[model samples]
Target: MTTKPAINLWSSSDHAAEYLSRAESVPHRTEGESALLEFIPPSTRRILDLGTGDGRLLALVKGELSERLRSEGTSPRVEAVAVDFSPAMLEAAARRFAGDPSVTIKIHNLDYPLPDLGKFDAVVSCFAIHHVTHERKRALYAEIYSLLNPGGVFCNLEHVASPTERLHDEMLSHLDKTPETEDPSNKLLDVETQLQWLQEIGFADVDCHWKWREFALLAGRVGAS
Candidate 1:
């Protein structure tokens, strides 16, 4: 029997638009996002947002860091780089960060190796990355590790695989989706395997910080020493 080829449809404008239209309604996602922010060190001065669709997560991180700094009476300007492959996403992200010299939006696909955009104090991704094959996911994690400054953190708010088919279907139902209606770009992996991969990649303090059904926040840090 011939195995069907893996497919990713995120490059299509219609698909990208459709996802953006409903991006806000993903259940318990805000809780997961809040959890992910706690891992970011207060001293972070630079950030990289991978697959930054509309710059939403980046905005939240930058805002949180700014607020934290302001409270301490030290406001060091934060710099951020937001990357995405889809033209529609890029456009939306550009609009979101417009006139903000702190954020730079770039076009890049996650299926290939990430470009050398310089090291980051913190690297983040949300509901992205899983668009690539499992092999690429592991490789991308390694690359993300390489891109981090020593002691920097990597936070990925992701859509992961449920352990059992029954749970997976149930998760879809919660999202008002069924298997046939879900995005074809999603190439879900189990959270346990992904957390293990982070540990194997030499990330210290690795763990799943938060999770609700198929949604999760996976984070780890480079050794501070």
Candidate 2:
């Protein structure tokens, strides 16, 4: 059954380690990440990375922003918060950013409402939001909208559902897995549905910014011009 898994394996070290070992090899992942970095404004001061698995995506965004600022001979400080519910993931992220005063790693489950971490100029998540139910997904988007600054952006590099079972099967084959063995925690929803949810939640410029097969980047802003 493609329904939600009865248990969340992500809390276990073995499951988190397995995913980390295979994380970089996901097809076109770098492409999607590059597109995500392009949308982040140069003036972004504070960032929140939801489900910050190993803090990889957050590292990329921070690196890009740092390099951009350095190129103009302007070095502005930036603050980052990396959040995940898994102890393994929290440990990995904390270690990755250790000794760096700019980043904070926090333990949080996306199934619940976001904590009062203050507003952010950009909120990002990569391949992590689909593990929650569809209802929570919408609510989380609403929460994200509320957490953003006036011109802030939310960019989610998500695992989305395909239109057909055949396509889904093909994608699984491409990843060298079957539905039987895939991560059962995924509560995949279509890109369009999520975009619509963002729009309905008062997001401006809601759209799918990029897509590669079952993977897509959904982006929306908090306020309009």
Instruction: List model 1 lDDT by residue over 82-158, tens digit each.
Output: 99989999999999888999998989988889988999999999999888888888999999999899889999999
Per-prediction tally of clashes? 0, 0
- What CA RMSD would candidate 2 show? 1.7
Name the runs in model 2 displaced over 4 angstroms. 1-6
Error at 171, model 2, angstroms: 0.9
In candidate 2 the C-alpha lDDT for residue 106 amounts to 86
True-structure lDDT of candidate 2: 0.91
The number of clashing residue pairs in model 1 is 0
Per-residue lDDT over 141-164 for candidate 2, one digit per residue giving the tens place of the 0 to 100 score: 999998899899999999999999
TM-score of each: 0.96, 0.96
